[model samples]
Target: MLNALDNLTRLISFDSVSKNSNEPISDYVSSLLEELNFEVERTTYMDARGVLKCNLLACRRPLSSHPKLDETQSSSASDEETSPKNAPGGLAYFCHTDTVTADRWTGPGGDPFSAIVLDGRVYGRGACDMKGSLVAFLDAARKTPHEEQKLPLWIACTADEEVGFEGARFLTENSNAYTELVAADPVSIIGEPTMLHVIHAHKGICGMQIRSQGHAAHSSTDMGVNANVAMVPMLQTLLEIHNRCLTDEALRNDAFDPPTLTWNFGVSDGMKTVNIVPDHSNAWASMRTMPGVDGKDIIEQVKRRADELGLTFTLYSGGDPMHTDAEAPFIREFCELASTYIGPNSPEAVCYATDACAFGQLQHRVVCGPGSISQAHTTDEFIEIEQLETGIRFYEDTIRRWCC
Candidate 1:
């Protein structure tokens, strides 16, 4: 069997960028899991571009399938055992198998897929963004003790996470596999770049577009209500809303960075030329709100404001916030395990979003993994060899804690 670093090197060799077919990586991972005696299944789906993709679910049998523990002995009491089983419930590792485009990653190597190891770091497109954690999880699973425990263990590698989380959505909406796996209310750990910090909360996301309509006419004629002019009031209203959220106690969550609702009106479209009074004008904006703050409610507020200004509004995308209780048993256990390496720390809330928001809706979930978010999408992205080893130990410990 390939070592963790070797597995990671093989994984990086596959260009599983978002929107591209991840069949190769899926095949590679499925083959590995099958070799390890896991019941591996793939939830195949087509991306927006109609490219074939998949979400892999590999389940190892429960500890009960192994020899029973002695009356006064713990699960670790035995040194000889068999492969794991996919019994009922157990802890799950959820990670996106897709990475963002590597257009900007111009490392010393010729290409992002080289997986160059220099200065004790693996430099590649997906090294820090994700593939690192997936490699660690795979390695830990390879090292798992066959001793008896109460629950099983699952690994979920979903596709299109960078492209609207379509893979996760499919798993949630279409797969009975996930339903069965989480039937026992197992804990889910989303493998994103958190530098091993246990992230318990994250803001929700909602994206919208507001359009203003008017009759087209020559600009000099003054014969039509300029759509651009009409759009100004709507933009001002959204700014006002943004400012209000900054000070609104109801929307504030001190645990997250900035501790306030964030609004970004970064896209707009309007008249084609100065000579024309635009027949239509539009602005695209997005908001990130604290957990427990409904993004739909914020959308409704925006819609109401648009209505007041006689403008049309449309919500194109959105996702719920994730907030696992800091005191959750799984969370405490994970933090304790992580603290041994990174030092003691409390559960944190990140302003950025993740696929955890998708799984968090169904069960207890937390976002914690190796590497740094700072290098996630940057050019020359890399993950330290030390972090990889740390992640391997961390995941191995976590797997043993719940699935001895």
Candidate 2:
């Protein structure tokens, strides 16, 4: 088997921060898969700065010369005909190549571009958050025993996950090639320093920016409407809605600890000077909700409150809620494998969102990967060497069981 940790070090060395560009890292991954003789497809998003940024979908089988067979029959024939040469019905391993900006902490370990291995952990921007899992999946594909069963495996290295899951959204809207998916994002793993746990569910997120407009004037003048001052009522209304969501028993999920809904006001605009009555003001807020509550409902309620306050607002970004049955066959199998390889009782639920929501909506059986959310996007971000090795083994074994 390829050394997963070594591969992880190399992956972490690339600076794929969300705002900058992931084209370099995406190129590296494409080259690696290409070297393995996998047919790579690059799906690029145009709006992103790194226009070269792409979602790399790699598979071992070449498309049929004639497009005449049904999906089931084609998959079956692919399995039988390519049994000795390639893999079977597509089983995809998905991960995002982009990361949140690494600007919080700076110093020796601050520069995320410089990946370092100290002690037994690999340190860099995307180490534990993601790049580690990407490497592990690639390593698994490289070393797994696919010749026996010859089940086709796909790797989806997407971009813009940190921003708004645009890459995943694009893939979901465009592709129907795979029936099974595994989103290798860290939060789903429950911030476990070990690879013993497999997460099956996570909350969904909805981000929004609210802007209000009015007439601008000096503080001493009451002739003009003060947009900044007007913001207070709307903010209060949102806070009330957020607090109500927290207290409402109906929104709570027994599966999650202290489950309800999460919201935070992250940013505000306008009102730069104390004496000026700002003409426009805006605020950014996000919500994390359980499967039962549609994010649209919450947004509508916010809009209703805004309307009641006579303010105008718009939805900057939004995402749907997702929940998959923990007893799903693939999830059960993965749980069993995790238990066998790492420990017993290995399933978990997380509160953060992931690309699994997108795949899950597409009816694909999805699960989270190894590593911890705690170490993600932090200074000196790292994943234990042991965790990396164990994750690779788990992935290899899982691939072998299903594909071989």
Candidate 3:
């Protein structure tokens, strides 16, 4: 527990904010992995401004097949089926090393990066949102018996998960560190704040922006068309679309709370002054589509509706929703391991999104970790001491079950 807390403190102090360069924290993680007798592969790439950003792929040396499993074992019998010797097909843990901006932190005393402990809770940015999981994973690796870990154990510490999935996108496309890992399609555990619950299904997110244009003229003139007025009906149409999605039985997925597509117009802009007719207006909306809902179809519907209103629309960005077989053995085994401490609980469907949505594209993935998602990105973010200890033990047990 103390070792895990120490690593968490060290990690939180680095201030690896999403908009800043992650070189320092990346180097620190690489150094720590090296000290644990793991070979580190750092995949470096330049961001839009040519600043260096990196993702670290570290795996235990002498990666091997499942020596602990019997030779006659089948894939149905165990999630860690035997693979070619030294192949990357085995247990892997994923976590984003970058954190959201801490400028909004309103906690008393020390700032977000102070890594302070108050009343059995560690207060800091990214403490619960995820630096704690990384620390727990590292500490667990340090305590694992070398001989017990017979299969490959890999860690992917990625960047740019907050603003965009660029880090994960780059790693999957360009990195050679885990070609076999992807090919083998190993069970992946994404460490996100889930209150130690196993998440097997969640909605995917995508966004679009609609811009309205009109000729600008003074209010006293009759030649002007109001972009704001043109946009109002389109906005109402979007609400109608939302209402339609809510009523569409075919678009429902019971796993999610609303069981339907959810949309929010997060940003809307128009005229700056009341006297002048606005020439331009735009609304940025986010859509969270349930798994099995065709995001492209939704976009097409919006496009057609916009065409009826004579409005131009653009898809700024978005990510697909993801789902893993709820009955997968790996998920069952993971939940079983967690149940030992926290008692039995079933896999849940969460509304929150994570890097798991990105990694789930390549493999079977589940999101589980200590702390609550409610605390993530809050002004006073924190992780309880008890949860941290439980997380360390959970990670240690996971390594033993899959690697050993």
Q: lDDT per prediction?
A: 0.79, 0.66, 0.78
The TM-score measured for candidate 2 stands at 0.85
Regions of model 3 farther than 4 Å from truth: 48-51, 63-88, 215-225, 270-272, 308-310
Best by lDDT: 1
Model 3 gets an lDDT of 0.78
Candidate 3, residue 251: the lDDT equals: 73
Candidate 1, residues 1-404, lDDT tens digits: the string is 89988988888999999968989999998998888777787889777788999999877866465422222222221122322322213578989888899887788686998899999999987888899999998888888865554566788899988876778888887776676665544567888989899998888777888888888888799797777777887777778777878787887778888887787884355445688777888887888867766656667877998888888888865567888778765577778999998999888889988887677544567899999999888889899999999998998888887777
Candidate 2 off by > 4 Å: 1-3, 48-52, 62-90, 106-110, 175-196, 220-224, 266-269
Best to worst by TM-score, what's the order?
3, 1, 2
Model 2 lDDT per residue over 1-404, tens place:
23677667677778788776678888888888986667777777675454555677776542332222234322222212234222224455778988878776452466676777788787788888788888877787778644543445567778888777788778766654432222211112212233547776667887777777878778788876777676788888778877877788776776776587776774364455777677787876787877786557778887887788777767765555566567655566667888866667645677777776565533333555677778777766777777787777877776676556
Choose 2 or 3, whichever is better by lDDT. Answer: 3
Candidate 3 all-Cα RMSD: 3.7
Q: Lowest-scoring 10 consecutive residues by lDDT in candidate 2?
A: 183-192
